[model samples]
Target: MDNDFSVDLDDILATLRSHDIVIARFVTVHRRLLFDFRSTPLDPPLVAAVDPLPSIEARYRHLRELRPRLGDPPKLVTVFWPRFVASLADTPAWQAVRGRLSASGHPGAVESADAALAGLVDLERAAQREAILGGRAFRTIWSASPSPR
Candidate 1:
């Protein structure tokens, strides 16, 4: 769907409130990869998207609250890819309240498991982030045009 991020801040919060704002984390340790999901809330609760205040601190504060929920990373006990998944699985020891889980070998999942694992390792740190931009709500700043100087 085409989202108009160009809208006012109120609209931004409205847009966020409309959907389930979540930050996803793909973590790994040893040899496992898993996906973690957290609910990101909108500030001011249910204020109708009317006039948007210049500062985003209001909305940002709510976003920051999500940090506690995100807890270090997307710490999910469920494993997606072993090794990388295991790697992700290993990081969230505290999040794993329901005892320890195991990773299943995807012997037939991919042709180059080693290459995939290497790629995951390389991307581990970089990929760790909020799911806000990951979603389509806001256009990636990098792709935005430079302002006329």
Candidate 2:
């Protein structure tokens, strides 16, 4: 399977459409991907996309590479990747980019984030299931506790 987290734009757009989130504007500025949308054609819970988000396997490999110095590689991998997803909208990098986009009067400059995220989660769950065997694959793959010291 492809290890990269790169997602197909058309597939993602289809998922967003399925969620009934209207795409006000979707653009990539300076190679940073962003999407602007509302929960419905006219509504609240605006959302934007932020990506290059790593996959579970990629994240696991990265931590494993740290080797002897790494404390509980599986644990770190489990905690970090989900944390990365949760913190996407709050990241300073994304917030700064959002600020600039809003200042420039760009459409989809993240008013408040959500609906698209929900759809993206749905897409991610399906993809990951196919990659492994089932949902929350990380939990199964990383469930082994570190050997006792």
Candidate 3:
């Protein structure tokens, strides 16, 4: 499985080719960011729809590779994708996560998929959730999450 994503230090990817909007879910019980999200761009307005994950195995394989880059062990985990809904991105949350990523050296760029998936986090913390999914639509920004989650 040459394409299988088993992230390693040797494979430190500077950028991911895929564009799935990773809704930074929240810190899990183990203190890892729970990045629950779908593979394809959800809101059509944010980005052009992409093909769904070829299979569950493909989805998990991505998670396995992405988690290490997010932190280390217990860094991130793609929790799950909820039902279809018109969720909006929280300005604060989106910026906060983007800032965090930026500080980590992977500053996320503003994009429609990022805006669209900004509010799709699965968090119990209302304020935090609001920050992540708050504010007006970021239609002005231009970026694309065209990969599978």
Candidate 4:
């Protein structure tokens, strides 16, 4: 018998578009696994999410083709494994990842891999800003506040 799992690409794409992240589950003939995408934004967050390995591979290929077409290359790419939740939680990986992403380029290109499925939403946002400012003059302004624990 063929032992393989299946995933809903549309659902995965939607989650990425909305949350910018995903933790999915997968069940094969013998075992279950998680797909996490807390590392590279170019790869789908499938380490925890239940998606067939083949499906994940296919998606990656498609995204690779789509990314540059939208605009400039993104800065950071991260992938996380749910099985190492404790290790990730205890380390500075998340902060480091965010930092890398922040430094990659403008936040305009710093979309999570999951969010990339929304058909160049980042480019659209950038275009809007360009239209308003007459150029790529934009910045992220923030108010000063104490870090919340």
Instruction: Compute the lDDT for candidate 1.
Output: 0.30
TM-score, candidate 1, is 0.18
In the range 1-149, model 2's lDDT, one tens digit per residue, is: 32344434444334343332222222211111233222222322334433333565653453344232433222221101222242344545345434543543435544434444444545554655655764533345554688666
Ranking by lDDT: 2, 4, 3, 1
After superposition, which runs of candidate 1 have C-alpha atoms over 4 Å from their true positions?
1-25, 28-111, 128-149
Model-by-model lDDT, in order? 0.30, 0.37, 0.32, 0.35
Local accuracy of candidate 4 as per-residue lDDT tens digits, 46-85: 2221224356555455445434333322322223233322
Worst 10 residues of 3 by lDDT: 9-18
The residue pairs that clash in candidate 2, if any, are none
lDDT of 1 by residue, 20-40 (tens): 231222333222222122323
User: Which scores higher on lDDT, 1 or 4?
Assistant: 4
Error of 1 at 74 (Å): 27
